[model samples]
Target chain A: MEALLEFLSFQDPSVRMVTLGAVILTASSALVGSFTFLKKKALIGDAVAHAVLPGVCLAFLLSGEKNPLLLIIGAFITGWLSLNIIDFVTNESKIKEDTAIALVLSVFFGFGILLLTFIQHGDYAEQSGLDHFLFGQAASLVGEDLIIFLSVGLLLIALILLFFKELTLISFDRQFAQTSGLPVKWLELLLTSMTVLAVVIGIQAVGVVLMAAMLITPPAAARYWTDYLPRMVLLAAIFGAFSGFSGALISYVSPAMPTGPWIVMVATTIALLSILFAPARGIIFKMKRQQENQLKILTENILKSFYHLGQKHQDMKHRYSFDEIHSIRPSIPKPRLKKGLRVLEKEGFLRKKENSYRLSAEGTEKGKRVVKLHRLWEVYLTEYLYLDPDHVHDSAETMEHVITPELEKKLEEMLNYPDRDPHDEEIPYT
Target chain B: MKKKILQADNPVTEVHDLTVTYDRKPVLWDIDLTLPKGSVIGVMGPNGAGKSTLIKAMMGLLPLASGYVKMFDEKLDDVREQVSYVPQRGTVDWDFPALVKDVVLMGRYSKIGLFKRPRQSDKEIAMDCLRKVNMEAFAERQISQLSGGQQQRVFLARALAQHADLYFMDEPFVGVDMATEKAIVDLLQEMSAKGKTVVVVHHDLQTARQYFDWIVLLNTRLVASGPTKEVLTDELLAETYGGKLTLLNEVSQEIKNKEFPNREE
Candidate 1:
């Protein structure tokens, strides 16, 4: 924790500058990334990131040294070209989008590797930091490099602000944007250019392979937390900046760790946590709600069975054997028997006498309603849907849990006061 | 008919001999259409009948292989200020993170221009549009949280916020619930009454007569087009749906030709 405080302080100017640069770059990329995420073009960033590698190498070969200006220009050219190629292959050929992405990604990455190998073998003395492009070394960013990153980041942010409305319109509805007389072609080009720029700036801190994660995961995580686009963008930027700073700090503290993987790891962890814990859409919460619903259905079904057995016997004390209940619900598993019994007993719907169970007065009424719904659905499905009598039971079983009482009455009327199901079984009274 | 005449007095849009193609295959061929200044016109067609492509071509969303579209006797760009569009519901990503009000405000962007932030007037206009669609109460709601019908209403509200003289909507009723559909129809009628020309691509045959004053019935080309009562006929319906059996046979033959090229038997 003390180490954390020391890292947080800007007492060391170099550390302060690096932290500032990382924060700016990450925030810019994440902000643009929010739109891409919404557009479902998350993998486009990956394709662009990998596609920039050959250009970076070409720039280095031409300049005989690491030139940021030449490299960025070359990266943008190649990134744009790669996007065109991806679009061409997807539209012209029968190749699916995922396949096209994979094809472009592998080919460009292979070319980059080949170029890097050629550079390593050749007699260029100043080609030392070229490997930094692969797994980013944020610690090496200083002076002009930091300045370039910060400026580009600021430019990206400014462009996003200026064209926020147009971008949203195109992203949401390209057809509408076009009809509304917005220059959709120019807007698309602008959006693609911004995304490439974001990816290029991020390659220094997040690296090429994991840069796509920085572009996608933050916004995806933010989506689970909010529905508003502006709030989503802001939250995604914050999450991205947090990941960037923490990853850089961890790598700074532990010299052996790579900055890019750590950043992606942090971002991915946040995304996963959000998917499972978000208030409205969380997986765990949904599962819990589903379980609660299932339990309610099970108890209702048990009460219903008890009521039917009581109506036949005309005695409250008359009990039903487990076998008799199982005969009524042939598809029910043995494990659910204990759970169903426990819920019924807890609800005062059933009282177990030795090995037999009987319905209480309140339980009898609820059971009769359930039986009525089951019979009504069966009659409706078989008669209205023209399903075979044998096929109606399974569908009715599923529908009984979800079909409302209002739907039940509608189904009843639609079937025109049917007396019997397709199986010749009698429907219960109101 | 009374509404159409009042709308015709304004005379907002004109299309002469418009043609469009995709990959050299004609989708919209030699189409002559005109939208009066203030009226709700329904564009209806069977599946694969180019209802969407027509709207797209007119909007400048899709390239026109031949002919052109004019708004108030001006090209699309020159008259952009007077035109607004609402696309099919399925065209957008519902998962987009934006507040309902934020989306509605986008209509005002063309007027506001670049680098300038939306002002209080823009906000008020956006709010008014939302109120027009009865969605003002949901201004702060997130887009994804709304139902299909609500989302359509929000999109309609965005188009309304544009405050343009002409509006184009594509498949606004698709996947929307009955209540939302009724609300949208009512809103479109209101827009036409207020002297805004509105064109919509519609699918439901039952509602076409009730919803639209003028109709354009299409099947790859114009089958019949005029007022709803005159254009929609059993003969036209038969022409649209009658050739399916022959078309299927042609498809099979094409498949055969592809499988065995240059067979001399």
Candidate 2:
């Protein structure tokens, strides 16, 4: 708690620098990743992240120093190389893109590990925290690192703001953008460079292995909230910055916990929560809709069964017992049937008297619509589509509960207001 | 106020000996076409007849293996601003994070130029185009909320906002409802009346006759290109669609199967 308070207070310059570095790096990555996610090129971020390690190691070896700028250039070069190789392999050969991505990612990451181990045992003096690039060491961030992040992050945000329309056009429809006189190739190159820059800036704070998560997760979470690009991008930056800040503090407060994985865990938790709870596209909303549909179908089926019984007895007031209803639909379990009955009664659709149930006035009108829709659909299918009458009843059974009043009117008009179904059964009217 | 229609000396679009290939397999072969001004022309062909490919190649979206495209009697690069192309309905991600107004405003991006935001007049023009397509009600709605027909209308409104002399549309009517289809046909006629050349890659043979006054029937090659009344003959249609082109079918099949034997080496 003390560590977290100190980190948030900015009293400790080192903790302040780490938090600020993480915020900018993750914000930039999340902004860029929104486009990458929409383009369906998310795995490319992974490949580029892994491909930058060897460049960082080689940059250290050649420069004989721990200069952040030199290492960033190295990371960008190798990251760009990996992207070009993937493009070349996909364009020139028969190998599919997923396979090519896998090959490149494993090879580059494996090579990076080789160089990393060699450097660890060598006679280099300042190579103590170099291996932290694998996971990340947010504690190692200092004044110089935050400066690099601030400039590069601000530059990327500016470029995205300048070319927002062009980037969006290309990502959504490259051919349309090209025909609209946008220089699609240059736009693509610009976007690739930005993505590479994001990955490079992010690798130091989140490390190569987990940087891809920083790039993709926040935007994915934000997508559930809104469908406007600017809002989505803004929300993604906020989500990423929040996770980055919290992850840094949590790691700082807890010993032996790394910041990169913690950041990823926090980001993933946000994504999961968004997926489960967000309106319009979330799982909970979908499940509730499904449940409502199931209830509607059940209510209609019970009403339809009652309508048949009433007609058979030549009486609209005919009351049916539990055994009689059970005999009509044996497929419905007893508990479910009882529940349906109770719900129907509660909704004023069914009335029970002395263990016998009959449709109320409102329920009778509803039953007529359901039955009319079924017959109308069956007739339209047989007459319009030339389907066998036998084949259409099953389909009509399902459509009866689903067809809206507008569709029912259209079906009746298309069938010329038919008075009878294909079976020559009289169609009821409301 | 009527818009000034440019009376350029060159035809709207002209292609000479155009050939396009994907992975060394020819998709379009030796196509020659000259489209004049103020007409709704339909490029008609079967499933693999390279109808969409012709527009893509002509618009310079895809690199041509041979031949060149002239737009408004000038080179494509020089006259790009004067042309608009609407790709197939399935080509774009409708779920992209944008409102209907934002997408329609994209049509004005060329005029807005790089680094400059759209003006209020541009926004009004975009809204005007949306009203033309009966989509003004959806202007502020996110694009993903639109139905398939509404989405097609949005794309048409975007093209209309371009105010281009030449337009290319690839199967705009494929999935839309009847109301949208009628609206598109009316829009095409209106554009034609305004002296703009509109080229559509179409599939329905019945509607092609009713919708266009000129037609280009293709089957990997130009089987016929002329007025609809003269070119849509039984013999030309047979040549364009008949199974007699077995060799072309075989080649297209090979390419579809992706058999690149030499690529392994």
Q: Which candidate ranks first by lDDT, i.e. highest?
A: 2
Over the stretch A308-402, how does candidate 1's per-residue lDDT look in tens digits?
66767887568887888888776778679778987788888888888778887777777776777777787777666778778878777667778
Scanning candidate 2 chain B in windows of ten residues, the lowest lDDT window is: B1-10
- The DockQ leader among the candidates is 2
The fraction of reference interface contacts (C-alpha pairs within 8 A across chains A and B) present in each candidate is 0.86, 0.84
- Model 2 TM-score, 2 decimals: 0.88
Residue-level lDDT of model 1, residues B47-122, one tens digit each, is 8788989887888877776788988999988888888878877777776767889888888877787667899999
Candidate 2 residue spans exceeding 4 A from truth? A1-13, A308-324, A352-358, A387-391, A412-428, B1-10, B99-101, B116-118, B134-151, B175-182, B203-207, B234-265
lDDT of 1 at A281: 83
Q: Using TM-score as the measure, which candidate wins?
A: 2
True contacts kept of 2: 0.84
Q: Tell me the tens digit of each residue's lDDT in model 2 across A227-328.
A: 888899989999899888876787578746667898899899999999999988899989999998888888889998898888889877788999999899
What DockQ, between 0 and 1, does each candidate earn?
A: 0.54, 0.67
Structural RMSD, model 2: 5.2
